[model samples]
Target: MIRARVGARDAMRILTEVARANGQIFEALGVSKSSVSRKAASDQFLSRSESERILGLAKLIGQVQSMTNDAEADAPAWLATWMAEPVPALGGERPINLIGTMEGQTVVSNMLGHVLRGGFA
Candidate 1:
């Protein structure tokens, strides 16, 4: 579904930007930075699953930005902190550790929703 709306280059750009903002290497997302560059150069689309993961990450980033009332420029650091820090609601698991799977994304998203609604995350 995300692939229908987002091109590979755009997804890679977003992923790369997020990784840089988080002070992390692209491999943290399970793909090498060179692979993303190669795909961009070739105009190849990301796999459906990869697209989903990127989209999920983008959504989470957006939510964090909205919640913080911070400029987009400030969002990456905030998101990185939030993801890397352990969450009591998640049984002390860092949010980033669970974001690679759909179920985990749902859990993170739901927690954000609760936070937005003024409930404990």
Candidate 2:
């Protein structure tokens, strides 16, 4: 399910909040901290690739929230744990290690969907 289009500013804000909540740095998302800060402070929109990254991350986070069905306060930690651990369906690769590229993000998203539907991963 797609959500409404998020503006660049909102994307950056969401990314920052998710990263902080997950105890991760911006670099984990293949973006520099300075760039995130600059984008957050400016009115300029993100480039196409960057926008995709933001949207992908948001999607994965949303999936994690849904799968865990945890309280909002614990969602981030649950997501962080899921991302950091190795997955059997991923050939034991940590989800975080694959999130740097679009293909990897798609794979992870699909894997999450499979798990959500009660399949083993």
Candidate 3:
């Protein structure tokens, strides 16, 4: 991803399949839809930073799958639903709300860590 620019189609695949998000997800990640559209039309790659954010989101989803051991191959779908659900650890904020920035992504990752550890109780 850092070496060669990530393909716009690849990013879109991550957004739709892994993140189960709409185009607004690009806005949340600070990527412009017009830009993505143009790049997709031209078969070009996304900027490094744009690619990084997409990869980061995919990594977060992958973490859910890993932690759940695939959970009968439903972890990705489950993560999409779980991301929108509020969590007490986040002051009742939904996990999806904190995923727009790197720091927020870390917090979400940590929150998942807590859950994996039996809620830190």
Candidate 4:
């Protein structure tokens, strides 16, 4: 629930661990560093849009990781590297760059699905 803010911090932690990601990722996902820190310091909640985007980031990470089928120990670094790499299917845009918006997530997700189905990514 947005009212409680339970997902904000956890989502951030997930991004940090899985992608070695930071404020750039958060900002791209529409959460400013100052806002996250300020709300965290006050033990307050993120705005609905911020919480939604962060949660979406968390979900995207899970989806990517599942597609990888890599060992658990390898997943973090693998995801970080994969996210940074550019894809021709995305006009040479890095997956990480586009993952901030819902539309981009859809594109990335569909690309992964394509790869899973033995199509090019």
Among these predictions, the greatest TM-score belongs to: 3
14-41: candidate 3 lDDT, tens digit per residue: 7666345333465567777778777888
Off by over 4 Å in 2: 1-8, 65-76
> What TM-score does model 1 achieve against the real structure?
0.78
After superposition, which runs of candidate 1 have C-alpha atoms over 4 Å from their true positions? Answer: 3-5, 23-28, 116-121
lDDT of 2 at 14: 70
Sum up the clashes in candidate 4: 0
Show the lowest summed lDDT stretch of 10 residues, model 2.
Answer: 1-10
Q: Per-residue error at 98 for model 4, in Å?
A: 1.3
Name the best candidate (by lDDT).
Answer: 3
Off by over 4 Å in 3: 18-24
Give lDDT tens digits, candidate 2, residues 14-85. Answer: 776667655553566677666656766776566666777778887787787777776654555556667787
Task: Give the Å shift of residue 43 in candidate 2.
Answer: 2.3
Note the clash tally of each candidate: 0, 0, 0, 0
Model 4, range 1-121, lDDT digits (tens) per residue? 5455544456546656753533357656666666666666676767776676666666666666687675564554554566677888888888778777788878877876676567876
Candidate 3 has an lDDT of 0.73
Model 3: what TM-score?
A: 0.80
CA displacement after TM-score superposition, residue 46 of candidate 2 (Å): 1.6
Compose the digit string of candidate 1's lDDT tens values, residues 6-62: 566987778766776564525445555676678888898777777777788888878
Error of 3 at 22 (Å): 6.4
What are the lDDT scores of the predictions, listed in order? 0.72, 0.72, 0.73, 0.65
